[model samples]
Structure formats: structure tokens, C-alpha cells
Target: MSELVEIREDAPGGPAARALFDEYIELVRERLSLPADFEPPEHIFASADVFTGDGAAWLVIFDAAGEPIGCGGLRVLEPALGEIKRMFVSARARRGGHGRRLLRELERRAAAAGMERVRLLTTVVLHEACVLYATEGYREIDRIQPPAGPPEIWLEKPLYS
Candidate 1:
């Protein structure tokens, strides 16, 4: 049966939100092939401060059973600009359009808050995510080669036409 999913705006540190964040961390570690003992940095973990600034928002999507299926956060990076972060869909709940829905809601929230554009960071290792961003109208704006790990790509989308 197709699951009924609902996206809710909530703080990153909330119970359900935290669970999704934990899952996302593990998935990222695996996708990036990091050591098992690696602990996520403060910015990558459940840091409420990151989503508390101007035009910022956090959203969690849950299935009909009330289990978190996906999550993402938007934070203002500068005037008229916002950044999307921590986007994830649980491995069990993917391919159900949850990621697209979560991303649309985040962009809607940003636009409603007067943001002119939104940007996100991703690496090639997250193939599905990069594809999703591309299909959602995001375009590669910049790329950076870190001292270690895969190169990072920054994508941007204008909130309005």
C-alpha cells in the first residue's frame, strides 16, 4: 500500500527529528565510506542553533504510522539567501517522492520568508541526492576541492522567477 506521508515543521532537536538525524548521519558516513567510529561534527549533528536564525526552518516527514521518513533544514545564509542542509530520506522510505516533497516545502518556506534564492551543498557520492537536486531545478553554481574527501558541489535555485 502507498503510505500517507506528512511533512511537519519542527525543531531539529525534537524527538522524531533527532531520530531522523541519527539515521541520516549513519547513511552519510556509509555513503562517504568513513570509519565506524567517526563522530559527526557539531554543525552536522542536531544543532538547533543552525536552524534558529532569520528565515530558517526545519521539516520532518513522517509516514502514516507516525514514524519519521525524511527530514531537511533551511537556514538563512545572508540577506535574501538561504541554505538547505541535512536533507535525508530514510533508506526504508525512499523512492516514494518524500525527498522531493521535503525539498519543495523547504523552498516554499524560504520563499515565504522573503528569501530570493536557496543553495545546497552535496558531493558526487550522494548520487540520488544530486540527481534529485538537478531534477528540482538546482544548477551547479560552484565546486570546491577539499584537502580530503570527495569534492563538494554547491547548487543554487532561485526562489522566484
Candidate 2:
């Protein structure tokens, strides 16, 4: 049977949030073939304060059995700019529209927070994510070589007309 999925907003760094973040990090590391010692930057694994503060939000998706399946977060970058961080859907949940749902919710929350634009960074290894962002109206900005992780493709979307 198909499971009912629910998305709920919550403070970051909680048990469920941390579990999802860890899963996301591990998946990225493995998918990008990063070394075992590699660690994601602090900004990507946001602290509770960041999500609870002004112009920020965290969302976690749970299945009908109350198992966490996916999560994403939005953080204010500037007065009218926000960033999408740590978006992930478990392997078991792939191809089921949960990622798209989480992304749309993040955009809606960002717009509700008065952000006119949103940006995100994903690696070349994450081709599915690149396609999703592009299909959702986010345009490629540039390529960035971050100090800690794999090379990334930067993307931005205008939230308002």
C-alpha cells in the first residue's frame, strides 16, 4: 500500500532533523566519492538557531508510520534572499514525488518569509537534483569549488514576478 506522507516544519538540530541531515551527508559523500574523513561545511548542517531565527524554516517529511523520509531547509542569506539547504529523499522514497513536494514547500516558505529570490548548490554528481531545480525554474548561476566538498553548481530562482 502507498504510505501517506506529511511535511511538518520544525526547529533544526532536533533528533529527526539530525538523522535526516546525517543521511543526506552520507549519501552525498558516497555519491561524490569523497574521502571517509570528509565533512560537510557548517552552513549545510544548520544549527537550531538558524532555522528558528528570522526568515528561516526547516521541514521534515514523515510517512504514515511516522518514519522520517525526507527533509529540506531554507535560510535567509540577505534581506530578500534565501538559500535551500540539505534537501534529501531516502532511496526507498525516490520517484514518488516527495522531493518535488519538499522543494515546493521550501519555496513557499521562502516566499512567505518575504524572500524575492532563492539559491542552492548541488554537485554534478547529483544530476537528478540539477534536473529538478532547473525544471522548477531555478537557473544555473555558476560553478563553485568549495574548500571542503566536491565542485558544485550554483542555482538561483526568483520567487516573485
Candidate 3:
């Protein structure tokens, strides 16, 4: 069955927001085959705070019944560049275009906020995510080696192009 998905902007610290983020982390850890005791880096967790500031936005996608099924955030990294962070759709919500919808919405909001480009990073293990980003016009730029955690593939897309 097709479910109606609605994206709503919200504070990253809300209870529902925290729950969705926690779920996203667990899914990523499992998909990447991380150790059972692996913990996400502090910087990654702290980055959520930036979404609560100016030129930034946090979005939660809700199902028709008002249940959150996905979440993402856009943060202005520089004068005209924004970054997509913490983007995820629940397992049950996959392959239904919800992810693409969330991504497009984020990009629209970014453009409306005067952003000229958007960048994001994901691990090589997230094959589906990598493919989605690539198919959506994001080009791989470089590999980022975080202080702690697996290396990440960086991708960027021009908003106006």
C-alpha cells in the first residue's frame, strides 16, 4: 500500500527527532557491519546542533498516521553551500520514493535559503545511498577520513544547474 508521507521541519532535540536519529544510526551501523559495541563519533552527533541555527533546517517525514518514517537536515556550511546530514528513511519506507522526496524537499529548501550548492557524505558501505546520490546528480568529489569512524565518500550537487 502507498502511504502518504509528509515532511515537517522541527528541532533536532525533540523526543521524536532523537528517536528517528537513533534509528538511523542503528540501521547504518548494521548496514556497515560495525561492531555491536561501536559508538558514533561525538562530532557526528554534535553536528545535529547546527541544524537548530540560522540558515539551517531539520525535517522529519511522517506517514499518513502521523508516525515519523524518515528524517534529514540541511546546514549552511558557507555563504552559498549547504550540507545534507542525517538523511534516512525507515526500512519499510524504502523503495517507495520517500527518500527521493525528502532529498528534493531538502534541496528546494536549500535553494530557497540562497544556497547555490549542496554537499553530503556517506560511507562506501551504504551502496544504496551512494547509488541514490549519484543518480540524483551528486558527483563524488573526495574521500574524507574522519578522526574516528570509517572513511566517507563526499558528494556535491549544484543547486542552480
**Which residue pairs come into collision in candidate 2?**
none
Every model's TM-score? 0.91, 0.89, 0.89
Error of 2 at 91 (Å): 1.1
All predictions: root-mean-square deviation over Cα? 2.0, 2.1, 2.2
lDDT against the true structure, per candidate, is 0.85, 0.83, 0.83
lDDT of 3 by residue, 38-132 (tens): 66675454466788667799999899988888888898889799999888888878888888899999999899888999999888877778888
The local lDDT score (0 to 100) that residue 42 gets in candidate 3 is 55
Error of 1 at 91 (Å): 0.7
> RMSD of model 3, in Å?
2.2
lDDT of 2 by residue, 35-140 (tens): 7777776755556577767878889989988988888888898989999988888887877889999999999888988999999988878878888898999998
TM-score leaderboard ranking: 1, 2, 3
Error of 1 at 92 (Å): 0.7
Stretches of candidate 2 above 4 Å error?
Answer: 146-150
Error of 1 at 73 (Å): 0.7
- Candidate 1 lDDT by residue in tens digits, 1-161: 25899898877888877787778768778988888777766543436778886688888898999888888999888879988988989889988899998999999989999989999988888899999999999999998887767878999999883
Best by TM-score: 1
What candidate 1 gets wrong by more than 4 Å, as runs, is 42-46
